[model samples]
Target: MAGRGLHHVTLISSDAERSCRFYACFLGMRLVKRTVSHEDPGTFHLCFGDEAGRPGTLFTLFPWQRVPRGRRGACEAWQTSFRIPSGSLDWWSRRLSEADVPHRLDQTAFGENCLTFEDPDGAMLALVEANPFTQPAVWNSSEVPAAHALQGLHDLVLKVREADPLSELFREVLGFTEIGRNGKLVRLATHDGAGGTITLDETGRLARGQLGAGSIHHVAIRARDAADQDALVQALHDRYGIVTTEPKDRIYYRSVNFRSTCGLLLEIATDGPGVDVDESFEALGMGLKLPSSLEERRGELELLLPSLPIPTCNRHVFEEIT
Candidate 1:
């Protein structure tokens, strides 16, 4: 089955408040939802994205408060990239400087210009020039103007020791076509620049990365519906001998996760019942939201979890990026 595009990317953070400031205040993503993780309800699961929290726009995090810092190396998603409008790099550079967030501007071997920076917890991220075919929804409440705001994710970068076996999975199982390659970086595109693209970087000498604070949790691929997700899951098991989790309801969407040959976690997620499924668009990310199962203990959870500043109308709390 052919995959649609990227659904979302989930990463680990040590400080939810700091992360929220970096993303919502500096980077200008909407704090779409705030809820507890299904697996570990004690910790928070925060969602950030474009205006409406579209599939490819989603950048989520699990705040593992006391976890140790992770090292970046092979067998990990090293960077998550967002698409920005053409010619907006200079504006972004100035903005980053104003916020005192250091970043470097560089061009890929494939000719895409990107600005790379780290979040509060050192999760690597970038903003690349958007492909003409990919138009991400503009965030109206963004600190930056709509024209200069970050678009949806352009692609993701995975570092591994070998690319052949992973290439097979991208081509055969994930419905991504090998578009181009430059030395150690191989580009795989789902719809030829329509959105979801992955670059596999072969780094034979580096050690494998550990999962902890500031590390990526999993890279989720987009599926149109349940049938499409099921087909891909079946293909993974039958063809690659990969064992994946049965579809688990994530409230926003249903997801199934598995690890790659190199040990990078991969998830296949449906595109709907989005972040606004429970909360309305107008009141998104306003307060702590709990699923029905956790509603009974909402009072207890509220007392335990630290309160985060609301980015919508309360921008003063995050006035300084330092």
Candidate 2:
């Protein structure tokens, strides 16, 4: 069966609030969820996306303040790109400049206009004009106007020492169609090129990537629901003899994870029980909303974490809660 599309891409951050300012305020995404990492309570897990925090639009970050800076190399996701409205590249370039975020305007081998930049923590990101046929939800709270706001994730780039095995996994297990190649970079897309694509780069000679601050943790592919996830999990174990985790409730969605051939983490996530399930649509990311297990200790955990604003870019979407 073919994968639906990209669900979300989760990455690391050195400071949650700095990342928030870049993604929510500068980039015009909405902060849809505020929670602590399931495995760690000292750090924060922030989810940013379109207004509703839809599956394909979601991007998450785990702020680990003490982690060392990561170096981009083979066996790592080098960049995460977003789709922007056609002809909005100029607006974004100026906006990023206003925020003092360094960026450069460039084009792909296929001649797609792209604005490439790095986050505060040095994670690579690009904004590419989307296919005009597809429309993205408008985020009204941004410092940017709705017409120029970011759409959602456009694609990801994975650099690996060897491409054949991982390429096989992308086509055989993940159901991505090999579209075309540019030298060492091979592009693959799901859902007949309608959804986000992943470019696997066969970096000839490079060190193995080390995950730390500013590195992508995993790339999630969309699965319809519980049964669909189950089928994919079983296929991994039975057909490919690859081990996959059982479905786990992530509050916003259900997920199953496995390590790829090159040790890159991959996840399959469902699209339901969305961002509004725990918080109201209008009040998303307003305050810390913890799971039932952590609810009793909410006060303690809240004190342990740093405070963040509601992503208004200093223009005030919601009154600052201090």
Best by lDDT: 1
lDDT of 1 by residue, 1-322 (tens): 7877778888998877877877887778888999998878889999988888888888899988767889887888988888888999999999878767779999876899989988767888889987555455667654778888877778888899999899999899888889899999999988744347889999988987788888998889988878889999999989979999989988888899999877888899998888889888888888888888999999998888766777542443224333
Each prediction's whole-model lDDT (CA):
0.83, 0.81
Clash list (residue pairs), candidate 2: none
The candidate that achieves the highest TM-score relative to the unseen native structure = 1
Question: What clash count goes with each model?
Answer: 0, 0
| TM-score for candidate 1 | 0.93
Local error of candidate 1 at residue 207 (angstroms) = 1.5
At residue 207, candidate 1 shows an lDDT of 84
Local accuracy of candidate 2 as per-residue lDDT tens digits, 1-322: 7777788899998777777877888777888899988779767989998888887788999988657888777888999888887899988888777667678999875577999998877899899987743456767763778888777778888999888788888787677888888888888888422246888889878988788888998889888888888888877787678898867898888988899878888999987878899888889888888888888888899889987766546643212233
